[model samples]
Target chain A: MSVKIEASEGGRPHNEILGFGLIGSLVCIYLTYLNVLTGTEIFSFFGGLGAVIALAWGSDTIKHLCSYGLGTGVPSAGMIAFGSGVIAMLFATKFGIAAPVAALVIAALLGAVIGYVSDKVVSMNIPVMVISLIELAIVGALTMMGLAAMAGGSFMFADLVAGSTTVFGIEIASYGSSVIGGSVLAVIFILGSIAVQHPFNACLGPGEQQDRTLMLAAECGFLSMIGVAVISFAFIGFGSAVVALLVSIIGWAYTYMEYIKLSRRDAYDWLDAKPIHEPKGGA
Target chain B: MENLVLGIGITALAGALATVAGAAEDTESDIGSQGDPNSQVQLAPQMGYIHRIYNKAVSGEPPAYGLWCALGAGIAWALMSIQINAVLAIVLGSAIAVFVQGVYATTAYLGRTASLAKFEQPVYIDIIKSVTTVTMAHAFVAIFTTVAMCQLMIVALGHPFPLPLLALVWGIALGAAGSATGNPFYGKERQYQEQKFGAGVPISASGNIVRYAEAGQRSSLDNGWFASKLGGPASGICFGLIVFLELWRTVLFEQIGAGWGAIIAGVVLILVFMVIDRYIETWARKTYGPYVAETEEAAS
Candidate 1:
């Protein structure tokens, strides 16, 4: 099963797809925020979609940059993305409706600065390191905000730090836990990182195909959505949480199936396992 | 004025501590044969040269250190909240994190060596029994120093981020510093010394590394001995400069014009580094003169 591979084996150029994911996910996430202003949590799934799209793009960026022989840097890139992204995100939430846009800007600037440090002072010498890192940072910020929105129904500073204390017109003391204060933000950080980094790490080889890898990213993203949806129960309305959970589960199933199909298509042949024969005489 | 002075002092202390953390981190990673170079160590078995190196790359240096520092800071923060002495809390927290790091190293080494059994790669019990503790000791130092630095920034300099988050951020910076500045020394120089100096690693020599030491077969410890001198110190200085400059600007200019002064200083610093980096690149290209086949033929 020796198959020759060329550099053009992947589905699309990395940049074009990445640009689409970037702009599209940003728009969808902003739309989710706008929906929040309508006082309805029904459109919160758009936030999850935003996260998935950003992760898909981020995964592509990771694949592109880590190919420069980063060796173990695949995961490090993801961690740095979130590390900077979390700081930028927390800073951005201080703005009211402009939080998402603010987060994108801050995350971009932070990533660029870190990338500069990595290249100039540390002397990584990779040509695309700065741009890739910038993209990863934006992806980290958007994914974080999206998941936070999906979970808590709002990406506002007050809602994320100390959510409302009253429920059903009754004051519930000690129930003021928000996404950040309750440590849910930590889960989102790690979940987004793993989802963005894992697909490429697992699919990296001569036989790796972009379609399969992106599908796996989508699968991982949806799985992360399921996780955040469960956490949403702690903050959002029950109906919205259920809706998110259902949507996530459905999306995960579809993407997982597509990933499997792509894998099979790429494979030369399939072999079924059989039980091993015991030695002539039993041990 | 007093606040500025205190901030400067804290920044200086943090920068010094971060340097130690960076040095110790690179040394630990080299001893374990972690990061990009670890790929060669892994490939040694398949390439028909069984090695004694401890391959314990559970993850990249940045994320791994981030997890350790964050975990340590989290524990320390919790203990301090419960009225424990700060030093004791930090010690205990770092100790627990080191234990976790040791466990990860052990499992990683064991699992990796086990996978290479078919290639006659032996799992050196001595390496595991001894090297795991060595790496853990270094990790303990790195974690403790980083946590302490985070504490200094919070309590002394009035940094806004919480202890764990701040530790995570600095840990990432430390890891990136080590990976970028230090790893090349180990991966390019020490691990593949047989290659002509200044000639980059060729694609043909991907998995082939220098397998023999001066006396006998080399272990990761041998690499560590060489790396401790150049790689570790280089990484230390890189990280130290980053922390020192980053904090120096803020302390000096943060009070001016709604903190725009600090931002301007940061931009200026970046521009200076860009010029320096450009000069360094030119110098290297001139000195080395591209060690490719075409250049070699022309010279001949």
Candidate 2:
């Protein structure tokens, strides 16, 4: 089996693909928001799960960076990504509610600052750490917003505050930014983290292949979608949950089949070979 | 037929759970939003929260001791609330502790690792790659298990355990479990490190620290890499208890009680952790025959 994953083994540049996924998710988020605005909620279902495809882009970045043989190993990169992602996501949701565009800007800025510290102050020597983290934070924020949108039907500030405010004896501030935040969002955040981090982690080796890892990322993304659906179910967002569930199930089946096929193609001759033909009777 | 029945049953159950969650949301949705201009006060702070926190973190040229005191005080304040908000403690409070403690613990891990001890001038990538990654792994386990246990508490009992107590009890116990099991991942990470860096870590199948003598290269025998197999989890449990208990006691304890709690909890955690730690140590020694940690070359 191929253990080492070369930087060149990837089919496309990590940044280029990350850009595509980012733009794609933004477009999906915008369209979904528009749909939510006009009262045709039909399009909203695709927003959350589709946006996380950007995470596949993030996974690609992980494969590229970690392949250089990060001395600590790969999972740290994943943790850092998720760590930065979570903080960026929280900040995004806080502001994204008022002016949705603000969330993206805030996330990018937060990521840039963090990247700056990681590079200049920390002196990691890996110049790309900052930019990578910046992108990770931005994409992470977007994914979280996408999830909030799916859970609450709109990431509009008012909706979330309304949803999360726990009224105890008519006290005004039971919790701030409690809206768009729930056990459901908690589940999505954790699961989304796994999706963004797991594929590259599982596939890493000297023989690691880009395509296989990407497929693994796709499989993980689908599983995360399923997790989102279950959380949506918990909150009784039946329509959204069902839509997400159905899409994830179909997508998972397809990706899993492709993954299995890739495994077969990439396997040792013995494992890949058809069963040995046996003589039925004494010839 | 049996598979079909099981599938149908699970689907129904899932649907039922979704409906239940939806009902909960519906109840909340019933409340009217207070989105008037007065709510603007509430909204303004949310926007500037990041900026304010940022300024506090970086802008001050304060006394070093003062900052350290503030840090401890701040953590103590957060831990006090663990009783009322377990979820928040584990999520937000534990997060801060894990990041800081993860850094410290991982640094200690690197320092204690016989192979890595000689290396000078640690950089961000090296620190990030191993320390943060290892810390994240253990913390991830702690967090995931804490969440799972919380879920179980909810399902088995009608109400969830108080957040502070839960954080303390599970923070240490699950931290121990994590220390015992999945936490030694970094010890095995040398193969990758050797592959990438190629300084001095050569595999000597006979389990000796392979030395690198070539100019412009550093190498160490691979034999001692396994020294931290038990150390990984030991440190994990040790730090987990120390940090979690510090938070728990600070917020919950009386003046005299704090001392007793510290001594008692510290002792108990050590004793319990050591038993488990020794088991894993024995397990490793038995599995991989006793190996030497010394290198042929002088320590860097």
Candidate 3:
């Protein structure tokens, strides 16, 4: 019994890491295809994908199960999946629908088929890669076909055969882009994780570190507002500047306050302080 | 009603004066330590000017300041009801005001945090969530302030009132409610810290001087004081100033439209806040001595 328990525990990390990598790779491919073919901006598509990856990496299903036992993984998994779906939608909206839809269909079908085959096949990395590629292909294909159907064109297999050249071109570009973007992002993540783990790191010592991360992210978001301001001012006139500045200031203040409140609450928890008064119900 | 406005104006004036005095005292004391006592007095006015700017920039409760500023602008529009339709005037005013405050606050946060290194944890998720939440809240504040002021006007005239009075009422209500609601969030700590330190302990010598300096540094790079002050009075000041600018713009240029005015206000608010925050911090450091000195003095 002890030997069996030890084996099971030892096997889990390998399985989990493999699962993470597979899921991440598949998601990245699907998003990339959508961006390249659909005309989505690289930033929007990748931003959402990055968020989904972060959620998946941070979530520990086994830990949840051990702590709460049964039914615990659903909420966390649901949130990650929902966030991914939103990212996909946003990507589709920005890039145009053709590539995303095709990628979606191709990726899904491929993932399902490979996942099934992997049950019989004894290989590890190859199976994961096969599943990911299948899903990417299915997603791309289905997306394209669906759009074609909407345009009142034929949805024949022959049409897909003819369209495959354009589809393949999109696929290559997307794949190349994803690999570069994801690799760079992954390196950043790895470095950050290492710094956090190190004992003597001065920048982000362990106490309530999550709040700091959130703040940094919020700060990045302010860039979009500036972009909006510049665009509005250029198009509309100096009057636009007034509206832009007001909106930016108020929004910033509110978010800044919220960040402070969240950090304070976390710090208080770390210090074992009594609960502070919550906001009154009305406002 | 007149008394309240008078009271607010007086308080704002007093706060401004106190900030100036505090800076002067600090400059005088700081001169000896710098081995240049003569240069200190000349520097005092410059330092005092900076202190006022900082006070203005980094003062106020976040949501409340924005809310009040919008309300003030709304009231200003309602005051013009005789010339324009009441509803249109109120809408135009509140929209301009709220938009201005929002933009201002956003720029301030961006400018301050742009220099910091990225964090290890996942920042994007939390930031997106918080910003979305805050933006929605700000929008609501704008809507609510407009509605509340309109209601006050309806009751005051015993008939459908003119637009100008409605605008005035809206501005007054927003300012008053904001002050009342925001005071608890912004000044609560000041009150508590003051009480804890007692009247005898020089206000300047309070232990919070060290805490504030450290918080300033941390917040310069990271959002260290989120939970405690909820960005405190500094955020509030940004909100208020944005609203003030929105009102000023509307009064100055009627044809520019509310939307554009708001956007401009937002950007300026951020720029102004940063400038003031920089000086305020310098004053704090100069006045209080080095952070290490304060810590050592406290320990001994």
Candidate 4:
């Protein structure tokens, strides 16, 4: 008897796509409420959401998501919503209500510019970090100046300046702490990850095939860490330092555990399979 | 002492396993089959609970335990000696403790033979997956818990804790959280699926690149499964740690001279580690010989 399996050409079901949209919308609404309640404008949230959606809808961006199990339909939708939500909240807190929209615009433009420049640059990581750091510095300076101008010699301005400065001061201090904390934590994470991978590679040997796939997975793992850092910095300002350290550790741990679990499962499956006996017992 | 003994024991066990496995698989015909044989060691299908326990136990590896314990003790002393709130001291101390632990682990293992290279393909993948998960968990805990803890400390102590202390505490918390609750089941499902298909089965790829670029989807699908599972968590943890550390230090510690001191200390330590790692790698290469030389030596 012969069996046949049919392949489908269509994309993910409409319902799944719609489900992501619905989730995105709900998150948007909640974010909007939070911003308004905090006395921040709503435009920041909307603008952030718009930017995220645009990225999700773009072919290049969607391709990247698809590389990871995130389907274009639902996963993209969730990414749009989640990314926007987080970015919006971060901007609102850091730059105030009107700043999120501006930040989104700036970030998009910056991302494009950086993308172009990165193609020309030999070392992408350092340049990217530098660009991000510069952008952050500019935004911070501008925000402080703008707030000072708006508060123009009134008691309210005094309070605003005090509050803004206080926030900024707090942010600065936190960043310092994060650097201290993150340096150590990052080192540990790197060591742990290396340790795990080293023994694994040794056991697997050098000519086991699938080198390209493993390399890609490792690259993706590293990229994922960078992505987390980018998103966090774009949203939370200085607070992202601490977040970055935590995120790096988490990423490393998750990758390590998952790899172990999957390998073990494969081993079990192999054990259960019927062994074909060769006359010479050689492949 | 117990922790040190435990660390030594685990290291010995792992080292023994590696030597035995290596020796067994060293036969001439086993060259390309290393990947295949390594993939054949899965003893359990759904050992999620067992995996979790194993992860937890291993997380407190010697380096981590020693660093954290030392930092914790220091914080306790600082709290008692100064007019600092015990809570603030403890939290900050813990954060620093874990951060130190992480640094030690990274320094100790990088470019060293004490790594996962002895296991197999899936084991390597698991290490990455677990690290990502742990990093994310740590990030979340640091962000949420530190905020709450700092606020409480401020209230109880009638002022915010010192910036150095805060940084230390936050770092430890994030590290601990990452080590404890990060993903432990990253690549299991994909490995099972591949096993079910019985190695060498062609797999289809789906994504925007496939539709627009006319690229062969199969090529990209190799890392797809594992990468997909890991992307979010990895990104989350990375971003969280960077953002949190940057913000916390800038806001709370920059005014104080201690923050700069800490930064300098960190840089110096990293430099030292880098040198050590380089030396270790050089030693390994010189002692083991090149892959070709080793192979020839074994044959003779």
Predictions' DockQ, in order: 0.04, 0.02, 0.02, 0.05
In order, what fnat does every candidate score?
0.01, 0.00, 0.00, 0.00
Best by TM-score: 1
Off by over 4 Å in 2: A1-5, A8-10, A40-42, A94-100, A164-183, A270-283, B1-176, B179-202, B206-300
Give lDDT: candidate 4, residue A157. 17
Write model 1 residue lDDT over A23-103, tens digit each, in one string. 878787887775567888877878899999999999889988887776456777778888888888888888888988999
* Residue A79's lDDT in candidate 3: 26
Whole-model Cα lDDT of every candidate shown, in order: 0.76, 0.44, 0.31, 0.30
Candidate 2, residues A1-78, lDDT tens digits: the string is 113436435476776788788777777666667655677554555666555676788788776665545623444555
For model 4, the chain A TM-score is 0.27
What CAPRI class is candidate 3? incorrect
Q: Chain B TM per candidate, please? A: 0.95, 0.30, 0.32, 0.26
Ranking by lDDT: 1, 2, 3, 4
TM-score of chain B of 2: 0.30
Candidate 1 error regions (>4 Å): A1-179, A182-283, B292-299
State the lDDT at A199 in candidate 2: 62
| Winner by TM-score between candidate 4 and candidate 3 | 4
Candidate 4 C-alpha lDDT tens digits along B164-222 = 24434543443333322222222233323433332222222111011111242221123
Off by over 4 Å in 4: A1-97, A118-283, B1-288, B291-300
